[model samples]
Target: MSQRNYRAAIVGTGAIAHAHAQALLGSGRAELVAVADVDARRAAEFAGKYGGPSTHAGLDDLLREEQVDVVHLCTPPQLHAPLAIACLEAGVTALVEKPPTLSLAEFDAVIEAERRSTAHVATVLQHRFGAGALRLRRLQEAGELGRPLLATCNTQWYRDEAYYAVPWRGTWESEGGGPTMGHGIHQFDLLFSVLGPWREVTAVAARQARPVDTEDVSLALVTFENGAVATIVNSVVSPRQTSQLRFDYERATVEVEHLYGYTDDDWTVTPAPGQEGVSELWAEGRTTTSSGHDGWLAAVFDALDRGEAPPVTAEDTRRTMEFIAALYASAFTGERVQAGQIAADSPFARRMDGTGAPWEKVRNP
Candidate 1:
């Protein structure tokens, strides 16, 4: 494998960009050499904090000037695809933030661009990189944990009015859907990583509180291809915040609870009668690395060095993104959406609320 160091750049120096910048620096194989944001002053500030790499007004200018190996897209949901496509065109890997695109249509466009480019696009669903998550996948595949029977993925956090006061926080055109797209997507992505593929989803979405254009809360019942069922809840109104996922296997029950990110310490396994052997499997190959941008970046760099596609590849990201679209489609249409049911022309594909969010109709009426 190659041992060459990589040049890295970051676009959109928002709050999430800080994590990307730090992760790039921590990777040891990559350097933060450039950054771009529409706000020149903010870009400059971000540059100053992170070894003062060059700052540009936008990705186009940054691309023209810097020859980077990877560009981290820390911009909002809408900008993720365009910025990533630009990176792909430049033959630079794009590490995009969650809700990789505003809609399935946009994500497909990015995927098409990727097919035509030499570089790749990776979504930053960092929770899947934790040591515990890795161990879980390994054990499950090795048949130590038995078949998955049921699961629950809940991302319940509090976001007040002030949080949505930001111009783009809660809008469909800007931030996409509410908690389901933004807050809980990490949990959703991590769940998909464990559960394999989903068959169908029945969901309901609502704007229970917080004045926003999108639903602040959503609940879904999903059936997986493996014959397992799961419940998912995404909300931003709960005062006591937590991100939790529980998987019930035939042999043992595994769970992880935390907010934002998690490590091995956050995971616990409860074995079924005579299934205590699974604990040993879970304990093997444990690492101190917590689930976060840093670990994900490390994996990306490793894949790049090995001349292989990185984790959270287009197929992986598309499945999770499709599930998000399916959740919204099911909620908006009051129908159970099957996998591969959403076509390019589907309203949900054109936009998250292609059929229009129910609450938006009531508000306008």
Candidate 2:
């Protein structure tokens, strides 16, 4: 039912890179063909740890050296665009990490590149395909959940001074933005996936937490194109580890919580008045998903096998980026940034340069 396995080449051997490589190895779906990084030593180190993936110092060399069918981009947000475009130019499909672009313009650039290149491209917004979300989709489609209404995304994650110690971790130039674009964005992706394309937004983002260059806290009021309004709160400064989406629909309410573990069973769907039997219908449509990152990689491979594109495309991610860019602009500029009103020329297009925001210093006692 499938063609031969597609070979794999990974870029950016960061912490998460190893996880992806390991998943690929474990899946038996693709071969570890090559790896590239700015630091040759790091590249070699990763290649060594894995199965001798060819190591390269940069993209130009890697693209020329490796016969990789797919490129897994594991770099920081700011680097995503150029590297992905280069991969496209080399006629390679790219599975990029979250926060697909630094700005809406860069997003358009990637989409344009994909349009022009021989390569079909996709991004990693992996949460939706999770077993929990998958079941939710089925339940909704089956009309067990009826018409969905309100949605809420809450992620209470914490990052301290140490987390930002890495040179690129907290910088606007390298990381794109703050937590709204980084730590909390995956959760945002999950929210958007379930809630659908959003309409107008009013948000406030702030960099009040650590020595970061972007906001650690953001609250947004967003309306969906379907006229459903949702409230979102994202932060890296909050204590307690939890993630949740509460979907209130016409027939029932469905919930998913706990980011790292569990599945559709985690959802407790409550049907509308006198519709108690809907719970059984929701439960009957159970599913299981590979770990979030693993599921995405597997899904990509599956799509490739099926001659279809990965579920999350550059255009899909661009919508998310557009909202995020608007969120940052709205919060940073103290204005209610308008969606669709934001163009490639909008201030959010480029990295936040020379904001003169102090690199918060912690007095070493």
Candidate 3:
């Protein structure tokens, strides 16, 4: 691919949408063509701030009006898959937000849509682009971590009732799940992206919110296909903190101790004195790519520029969504959800729409 300026549009103008706009604008690779949101004011605000193109009512209007070559879907989880598919159908490449869709079925829809269209498709897993993420994968693949054994991810964030006051939030209908889907998903995305797939999940969810039906606290045990076990603890009850993940392997234990984002010193691969030196040797011998643009859209731009696939692909995201779906099923049924067996309309399917935990506990704290 020859070097050329790319035109792009962002589909959401909410809190996270700003990052998309900024990343696209600053990357010196793609231009901020347009942004759309249901709230016209929000869309207009983003349009004014980011420059270029224009805003429209919703995704349909935006897609119909803009001659955009790339579409960045930063909408809520439920809208990601459909909008992505819509973009692909329009012959436009797409980069969707995290927790790609409400279920694996929807993700499969995105995949099929990708197959149906010539557009490049990707899941927005920007966390996988971080410097730590880049270096860690190199070590793991080179056997620096040996055979990974266990890992833990803790994502605890605090949000007041006012935060959930947004109509779509705290409801299973709009935002997908609660903390596990909204907040904690970032850390775990990095987890599954690096550690690979899981075989089973045992989870427990609690309603600690003010008056929402979605879970506020959740804990789960994950068994990876590679014979590794991991634990996940996600909550909205603690003080504001950064997302973190710790990986334990046969040769080393690596950790990202910072939340929001981290680059230097946030990750470490430990060794038994001199045993894992082989990994160090391998790392020194090769230099790949690592970047701070942790969103899928910017990474997609780079991939297009290089004629390569994005680091986080649709199948990669499906694995995490697969884990999440199974976790919810496991929580509701109080049983172990065997991987590959948890499918749509399974016996353990929880009432997916505003019917989980408690709205009360989620509201106050």
- Note the Cα lDDT for every prediction shown: 0.91, 0.77, 0.75
- Model 2 segments more than 4 A misplaced: 285-291, 333-335, 351-365
Write one digit per residue (lDDT tens) for candidate 2, span 154-257.
87788889989988887767777777777677777877887778888888766776876666778888888877788888888877878777889887787777
Please estimate how well model 3 matches the true structure, expressed as its whole-model Cα lDDT.
0.75
Instruction: Give candidate 1's whole-model lDDT.
Output: 0.91
Give per-residue CA lDDT, model 1, range 1-365, as digits (tens).
76779999999999999999888887788788999999999999999999989999999999999889998898878888889998999898998988899988899999999999999999989999888888899888989888999999999999999999888889999987899999999998899999999999999999898999999999999999999999999999999999999999999999999998898889999999998888887887777778988878888888998887787899999998899899999999999999999998798988998789987788787
Q: Where does the lowest 10-residue lDDT sum fall in candidate 2?
A: 353-362
Which residue pairs in candidate 1 have backbone atoms (N, alpha carbon, C) closer than 3 angstroms, thus clashing? none
Best-fitting candidate, scored by TM-score: 1
Which segments of model 3 are wrong by more than 4 Å? 276-298, 306-311, 347-365
Ranking by lDDT: 1, 2, 3
lDDT, residue 69, model 2: 93
Give the runs in model 1 whose Cα sits over 4 Å from its true position: none
Clashes of 3: 19
